[model samples]
Target: MVLDTVMTTLHVLVGALWVGSVVFVAGAILPAAVEGALDAAPLEKIADRLVYLSRGSSVVMFLTGGHLAGTRYTIETLTGTGRGHLVLAMLALWLALAALVEVGRSRLVDGLQEKRVRTPAAEVTTVFRVAAVVGILLLVDAGLLASGLALY
Candidate 1:
């Protein structure tokens, strides 16, 4: 019973982290983007901060998920069911997040700091729109995983 409760709690915490990040990016960050407040300097700083936090959170979630699945329930059982789909979704999101971090750092931060490029409206719009889509995908993935539907 205790083990079940602990797994449930950890699962909930991971879901919160994933969903909360998406909510923050969409509700708060997207508005800033639409308003053009997501320009060079501010956007660079915010991206840097978010990237770091996301990296750590992703690691924690992956580790915890692996442990819970391996220790509590057999990995084979999860794979036999459709839970593997959720895991694959998570992996895809993690890849997207990693790519976003790399691009944000290389282009936005480096370019702005080095004056290689100026902050343009079109570029900002593109970046934010893509990020918004990714955020929405992440939210959906988290919701599906947390719903226990994947296990059915």
Candidate 2:
């Protein structure tokens, strides 16, 4: 029971950190950078730092989440229960978030290194929009999971 509680707490905490960072970047940092209110250099630096944090937190989340899933639910439960469905949904969201962040970071780096040329605002906006949507959805799903509604 103690182990279960610890794993759950770690999973939620790390997931929160990951989602919070993405939302902040999408809602604030990207917009400011795209609008020229922020410098490209600082934006790049922030992105680099966030990439490390996001990736690290994601790993922790995966480890704890996997443990919880493996220990708490059997294959039958996973396929037959609402909580299991939520788990699957969360997994898909995680994959989507990972792809968006990795691809966006590469593009951001390319834009930043292009001889003082800013990455096109439209491109950044697209990536930010997609990430923000995914992040928001993840938060909502998490809330449901926490509320036990995911077991419905």
Candidate 3:
């Protein structure tokens, strides 16, 4: 029970931080850079931090989420119930979000390396948007799973 609480807490915390950061980058920082309100050097630094946060959160979530699933679910339950389906869907969203974050950062990093900022930010804006959307879906799925659904 204590393990469950700790894992759940860690999972939620990391998810929120990573997702919130992505949303902020997509909704504000990227736009600011595109509009000439920010510079390439600072944008590159922020992108590096964003990538680091995303990677760390992804690892933490993978471990904690895997532990939670192992403790609470089995092959049969995971494949045969609503909550199980939600968990599976969340897993998919998690993978997609990870990929999007990596790819978006790659775009920004590559652009910054080539001595450009606004263009790269503009190019990667849509990717970040999609990632943020996926992250939101994962959070919503977590909520649905937590709404007192029967545990298997």
Number of clashing pairs per prediction, in order:
0, 0, 0
Best by lDDT: 3
Error of 3 at 7 (Å): 0.7
User: What is candidate 3's TM-score against the reference?
Assistant: 0.96
For 1-152, candidate 3 gives per-residue lDDT tens digits of: 99899999999999999899999999999999999888888999999999999999999999999999999888888899887888889899999999999999998999989878889999999999999999999889888888867454
Worst 10 residues of 3 by lDDT: 143-152
lDDT of 2 by residue, 28-102 (tens): 778777677776678778878878987897789789989999998888878899988888888889878877887
TM-score of 1: 0.66
Worst 10 residues of 1 by lDDT: 115-124
Stronger candidate by TM-score (2 vs 3): 3
Ranking by lDDT: 3, 2, 1
lDDT of 1 by residue, 1-152 (tens): 78756765776576466546545654676466546666666756665776676677667767766666566456565566576667667667666765664454455566556532334323444554565567567667767876888874
Cα lDDT listed for each candidate = 0.60, 0.80, 0.92
